[model samples]
Target: MNRRVKEGTYKGKKFNAICHFFGYQARGSLPSKFDCDYAYVLGHVCYHILAAGLNGYMATITNLRNPVNKWRCGAAPITAMMTVRRWSQNPGTASIGKPAIHPATVDLKGKAYELLRQNATKFLLDDIYRNPGPLQFDGPGADSKAVTLCVEDQDYMGRIKKLQEYLDKIRTIVKPGCSQEVLKAALSVMASVTEVLSVMSSSPINGQSSL
Candidate 1:
C-alpha cells in the first residue's frame, strides 16, 4: 500500500513521495462523544456479565443508534464468534491454527460501499472534502451519528418485534388457569422482554441503569 501511494500516478500527474502513518496519534487523542458512550455501556455490560458468573463469553451492546439506555445488552460465546486462522508460533516452530476474532471489514455489497463505488470516479479527481468538525455533545452534528449503528438497530428491532408478536399470540392462546410451571416460565420470559423495553424507553443521561 505504501509503495503504491509513493509511486503511483493518477491521470497524467505524478504523486509526491511521502509516507506518513497516523494510527498512534489518532489512538492517543481524546475520546469523541460516540466513543465515550460506547465505552461506558460496554464496561457496564461487562460488569453485568461478570456478576452473572458467565465465562467464555464476550459482552456486547447493540442498537447504539438509539440512546445508551436503549442499547441492547447480551453475551456471546467467544469461540462462536471466532474463526480459525493459521499463525506461526515462532521462527523455529511449525505454524499452528488458532481461533481469533478478526477485525471487521467493509462489506462490498452494502449500501455504504455501493455508494462509494458509484462515486469513485468523482472522488478520485475532485478534491472535495467534508470537514465533520469536532465531535459535539449536543446539536445537529450529535444527531447525525453512525449509519452502521442505525442499520444494525433496524435489523435487530425487526427480529425482536416479530418475537414479541409471537409471545403476545402465545399469551392470548394460553388459558388463565394454566399450570403454575407453565405460567411461571411465561411470566419470566415476559418480564425479561419488559425489562429490555423499559431500559429502551428510559434515558441514560437521566441516570437510568442500562442492562
Candidate 2:
C-alpha cells in the first residue's frame, strides 16, 4: 500500500495516511451499455487480427456515433503507440530502457477541458453535485449517450440542413429556361459545398467545442 503526507497539521502533528480507495468498487461494478458494446466490438476486431496472424498490433474501432455495423475498424502497430520512458531505478542512465505504451492523458485543448475551464471559477466556490443516476437499459435514459456522440450527430445534422438549403436554392434558380452558364455556376457551387461537407464528416470528432 502506498501512503502520502496530507496537507496541514492536526493538533500540531502532520497527518500521513493511506487514502480511502474506491477503485476496487468501481472496477467490480456492472459496466454501462456503451462500455459493453465497445468491448464487444474490440473483441471481434482482436479475433480477426489473430486469425490473420498479426502481431505487435492494437485493434481499433472508431465512429462511435454510428451503429456498430458502420464503425471503421483497423489495426496500428503497438510500437507506433508507444513512447520511450526513462528508467526511475537508474536516473543517470540514458537509452537503457524499452519503450512502453503511451498512457492516455486529458487534452487541455479539448471541449471537455474548455467547458471545465470556463466554469472553474464558479465551480470552486459552489458545492455543486450532479448525479447522472445509474445506467439505464430502457426508457428515456436508454437513449442518453456521451456528449461527444451527441455533438457529432448535431454537427452532421447541421451539415445536412445546410445542404438542403443549398439544394432548395438551386431548385428555384435551375429550371428548364435557365442558361447553361448559370447551371454550370450552380453545379460548381454545389460541388464545392459537397466537398466541404465531406471533409467535415470524415474529420475525427475530438470532443469539438460545439458540444
Candidate 3:
C-alpha cells in the first residue's frame, strides 16, 4: 500500500522485462539470465526461477510459454532493506543502502562498462529513443519483477551441483506425465525446505539465522 512499495516494485519489474525482452530478441535464446550477478539481470532470472519453479511445481510450464503469467503480486516491506538518515552536507534525510551508487565500484562493473563505451554513441545519444517506462499492471509486461530475492534452498555451489539433479527430478513430476495439482504442492514443499539460511558473516551471529 505504500508509495515506495509500488514505485520500487514497478521499477524492478519494468527493468527486468525490458532487459530480458531485448536480450532474447537479440540472441534468439535465454541463458545467463538464470544466473546473472548484476542486480538488474539477476532480478529477471530470479523471477523466472520463482515463477517457473512455482509452475513446474504446479505442473504448468505452459504458463512460461505465455511469458506473461509469472507476475509477482506482493511487495516486500521496505523497512527490511532500507534506513533513513540525516546528513550535514544536505539538511534533509536520505534513504541509503546497497542500491545507492558508489563511485569507487565503477571499475568493478568490468565488461558491462565496456558495453557503454562501445554503444555510448547510440545509448547515450538523443533523438533515437524508446522508453517502455514502468509497465502497466496488465498485459504481457505485468508478470516479472526486478527485485532479487535469495530463496536459499540450496547453496550456490551446491545448487549448481544439484541443479541438474533437481531439474531431472522436477521433470518427472511436471510436464505430460504428472498432474498439475500435485506439481504445485511439490514445488511449494521443495522451496520451503530449501530456503536460504540467514547467514550473517558480518555479525557475531555468523551462521545462525537472524531473528
Candidate 4:
C-alpha cells in the first residue's frame, strides 16, 4: 500500500474543489417493485440464452408494462448493438475508432424527462416523500412498472409487428381489382409516408439505432 507523500494539503489542489461522500444518502434498503420483477424475468431469460449456447448475446425482456406472463423474452447479438465511432483531431480530418456499446441516454425531449423536470423542484424541496417499503412479489404494487415505461408507449417490438400487419392489410386491400377510390387513397397516403420516411432516412448515419 502506498502512503501519502506529504499529508499537508496535497500537491496542486484547487482552492475551490471539494468532495463529498454519498454512501449514506438515499440508502433505503427496499428494492423497487419494477427492479425486482425486471431482474427476476431477465434471470430466466438469461438462463434460456445460456442453455441455447448463445455467445456474445444479451438477454432481453420487453413489454414491462404488461403482466409478467405477457412479457416477451429474446436475445440480441452484442455486435448488432455496437456503434463504430469516428475520431477527428481536426474538423475536416477523421480516423475510425473501435466499435463500442454506448449506454442509452435519457431523451430530454421524452415525456418521462418532462414529467421529472416539472416535479423536480417540488420533489427536492417539499416534505412529500413516501417510502414504498420492501418490494412486493404478489400483492398490490407487485406489477408496477417504471415511470418511463408508464409515460412512454415503449412497446417497440409490438409496434413494429403491428406496423407489419398494417402493411400486409394494405397489400391485400390495394390489389388490381380494388376500387379506384381505394387505390387513389392508398397511393396518396403512401406517397406522403414514403416522402417523410425518405427525408428521415437521409438525415442520419452513424450506426444501427438502439433497440
Candidate 5:
C-alpha cells in the first residue's frame, strides 16, 4: 500500500476540497452568529451600492469592530484599491501586468501581531484555549468582534464622523456675527485645509493614476 501510494498508483478520482474545520467548532454551527450577521449586513450594503449606481465599485463597511448600528455602509471604486505589477518571467525579461487588487494579509508589525506574540507563551504551555461554545443570538457574546479587528484601531467611519463634528463646530464659531479677526483666522485655516485636501485627492494610489 505504501509503495503504491508513493509510485503514483492510487488515483481513483480528483476533486478540489475546502476545509471547514473551525466553522464546525460550534454545536449545530452550519451558520455561526458572526457569519450570519456579517453576510446579512454585506447584502444590505450591496443593495445600497447598486442603488447608488456605483458600477465597478466595492461595498465597504467601516467601523466593523463597533455595533451593527454604527457600521457605515458605502461604496469605493475597485480601481482605487488596485495596483500595477511588474514581474520578470525569465532572466532579463520583464512583464507589466494590469492593475489588480491584492489580498490582505496579517501585518507583522501591526497591533494584531503584537497581541498574538503577547499570548504566545500562555497559548503554548498553559492549556488555556477558549471555546465560545454555540452561537449566541442575544446579549454579550453576540456583539463580540474578531480580536484582530479590535486591536487594529481602524475606526475610519468614527474618525470621519469626528471630523464632520469639528467642521460643524468651526462653522458655528465663525458665524456671520463673529469678530473680523476670528473670521480672518477661520478663512486662512479653511484655505490651508482645502489646499491640502486637493493635493491628497489628486495624488495617485498604489502606482495608479486617479481618474
Candidate 6:
C-alpha cells in the first residue's frame, strides 16, 4: 500500500511508458540500469510461503503482495475476519457482526498464526514486521533503533512504552480490582501519553513549525 501510494500518477506513467516501449526488465529487456533488490531473498521464501495447501492466498499475478492461496498465511483479528462484506446485495443471512466461534477454529488455536500473534517485538523493518508508527508525523516516535527520533523523542517513546504496558495490564485485571494505585496509574498513563501525542500532532517540516 505504501509503495502504491508513493508511486503516484507520474510514477505510474513512467513505469507504464518504460514497459510499453521496452517491456519489463525482468523479461530480459531494459532501457538503462535498474536495481530491484529486495530484503529477504525471494528465492526460498517464495517456495514454501507459496507452496501447496494455500492456493487462494497467492495473488502474485494480480500485482498483489503475498499470494493468498494454499501454503502461506497472513491474518487479521477474528473480529476483523468475521466481517464478510456483501458485494452486490445478494445474501441469504447477512452477518455483519463477529460470528460465534465454531469447533474447527478452536482445534486450530495453537497453530503458527496464534503463536505468531503472541510473539512480541520491539523493533521493525517492514510492515509485516513493524507498523512503523502510523506513517509518522502523526504519533509518537518509533521505538526501533533504525527509526530516527523526533520532537520530545525520549519523553515520547518512554510514554508510549508505558502506554502499551498499561493497556496489556488492563486486559488482565478483570477480577474486580479495587486497587486505587493501579487505577490511578492507568489514568496517569493515558494523560501523559496524550500530552506527548498532542504536541507531536503538528508535523515538523525541516524543523519549521506548521502554522
Give the per-residue lDDT digits (tens) of candidate 4, residues 45-138. 8999889998999888777777777777788889776665656688888665766685588789999999999999998998753434556667
Tens digits of lDDT, candidate 3, 43-66? 565586577544322111111212
Give each model's whole-structure lDDT.
0.69, 0.68, 0.42, 0.76, 0.76, 0.40
- TM-score per prediction, in order, is 0.52, 0.49, 0.22, 0.66, 0.62, 0.24
Candidate 4 error regions (>4 Å): 1-30, 51-53, 88-94, 130-132, 184-211
lDDT of 6 at 211: 35
The TM-score-based order of candidates, best leading, equals: 4, 5, 1, 2, 6, 3
Give the per-residue lDDT digits (tens) of candidate 2, residues 102-210: 5677778777677778889988998764326777766666555566564343343345568799779879999889999999998898799889988865443333211
Candidate 2: stretches off by over 4 Å: 1-28, 86-94, 121-133, 148-211
Error of 6 at 95 (Å): 48
Q: How close is candidate 5 to the true structure, as a TM-score?
A: 0.62
Clashes of each: 0, 0, 8, 0, 0, 15
Residue pairs with colliding backbones in model 1 are none
Evaluated with TM-score, which candidate comes out highest? 4
When 1 and 6 are scored with lDDT, the better candidate is 1
In model 3, the worst 10-residue window by lDDT is 57-66
Indicate the TM-score of model 3.
0.22
Better model by lDDT: candidate 3 vs candidate 4: 4
Error of 2 at 120 (Å): 3.8
TM-score of predicted model 1? 0.52
